[model samples]
Structure formats: structure tokens, C-alpha cells
Target: MIRDIFENAYAAGAYSLAGVVLMAISFLVLDLLTPGKLRQHLWADRNRNAGILVASNLAGIAIIVTAAIVASDGRLVEGLTYTAVYTIIGIAVMAVTFALIDVATPGRLGELMLHPEPHPAVWVQSVAHVGVSLIVAAAIL
Candidate 1:
């Protein structure tokens, strides 16, 4: 019984590690899309727009990871695979959406990332991230 418990714990840890890696990758993707270093904007500058966008991106990744784990049905290998693939897809879609929104708008989206004030464009992009994640999660199910 103890061995079974330990094995389950190991599986859980594996899934969690996979989720963390995927989340970090998503952050990098967002950092590349925005202006300046994300850490500087988020930590030193304390930019609300960057914070909102990063928060939404992380939440979206969590949604995708959760859906993948649930759909895995206790299969560790399959769960990790699904989580990684879905996360990559989610990131790609979010990047493309960001680009499209930038082209459709007046000024540069990257410029807005460091605007120091709350911007409607940031909120729209945030919603887009979460919305795309939901769509990807639903597809996983």
C-alpha cells in the first residue's frame, strides 16, 4: 500500500513538473512578444499591463494543463505528452492572435506593454489569451 502511494505521489510530481515547464515556456513566448525584458517590466517597473498579460497567460496555461491531466485518465506518459502539445499549440495561437491584434490596431502592441498605465488593449489581449486557452482545453476534452 505504501509503495502504491509513493508511486502515485511520483506521478503527481511528474505531472506538476511538466506543467511548470510548459508555463515557463509560455512566459518566454509572451516575453518575446512584448517590449523589454518581462522580468524588468514586471518586477522593477511594476507595470500593470505586463502583470495582467502575464497573469492571464499563466492562467491559460494552467487551464490547458488541467484539462490535459483530466483527460489523461491516470496515464502519466500520455498526460505529459498531451500537456506539452496542447501548451505549444496554445502558445502559438496566442502569439498569432497578438500579432493580428497589433496589425489591426493603430500603435504597436509591444509599445503598449510598457505604457505604465492600464490600457484597454492589454485587457483585450489578456482575454484573448484566456479565451484561446479555453478553446484549446475544450479540444483536449
Candidate 2:
């Protein structure tokens, strides 16, 4: 029984990881394909630091999705409702957390997320998003 559970969890985690990789690649491609005008207004011109910020946000989403998938134990059909709920909750939590962190640290978070700097906050937010996703996924499951 224990072995089975572990195997299931491993499978789920692997699935989730693949999803994360796909999402990251997709976002990167989209960023590359985006027009200079829209990109400037939405991402570049605003702060000239949109790349990392956008990447971090995308990374956070991937983490949340992964957590939800892992929490579902690979039972996507059965866990559809749980995944949706957890995704919503995870997004909300991440938004709030980012807001608070931004307020507390000023441009620090933005610099790391928006700029090309290595921001620990990105990891922190990703972890939190994943954690919340897992909780909500588990509750629904």
C-alpha cells in the first residue's frame, strides 16, 4: 500500500513537472513573438524590466498548476473540480502575497521579477502559490 501510494505520487509529480516545463516554454515563445509596440507598452516601456517579471509570474502559475496536479494524484478526470478550485485560490493567494511583498520591499520584488536580477522573492511566491494549490487541491480531492 505504501509503495503504491509513493508510486502514484511520483507519477503525479512527474506529470506536473512536464506541465510546468511546457508552460514555461510556451510563455517564453509568446514573449518572443510579441510585437514590439504591445510589448513596450505592456512590458518593456513601462519599466524596461518586464522580462523577468513576466517570467516569474509565469513560473508561479506553473508551480501552482504543478502542485494542483500532484495533489490530484494523477486522477485528472476525477480531480477536475479540485484543480479548478485550487488554481483559483492559489492565484488569489499569490496576488495578495506579491502585493504585500511589494509594499514591504518597495522596488526590490519588482526588480527581481521585472528585471534580470536574481530575486529570491520569486521563489518565495512560487512556493507559496504551490503550497496553497496543494491545500486547495487536497481539500477538494
- Note the Cα lDDT for every prediction shown: 0.92, 0.54
- Predicted candidate 1 versus true structure: per-residue lDDT over 1-141, tens digit per residue: 999899799988998998899899999999899878999999999999899999999999999999999999989899889999998999999999999999999999988866898888899999999999999999999
Residue-wise lDDT of candidate 2 within 4-68, one digit each (tens)? 89977876766566556545553544344333432563454564345444555566555556556
TM-score of 2: 0.45
Best by TM-score: 1
lDDT value for candidate 2? 0.54
lDDT of 1: 0.92
Alpha carbon lDDT of residue 35, candidate 1?
79
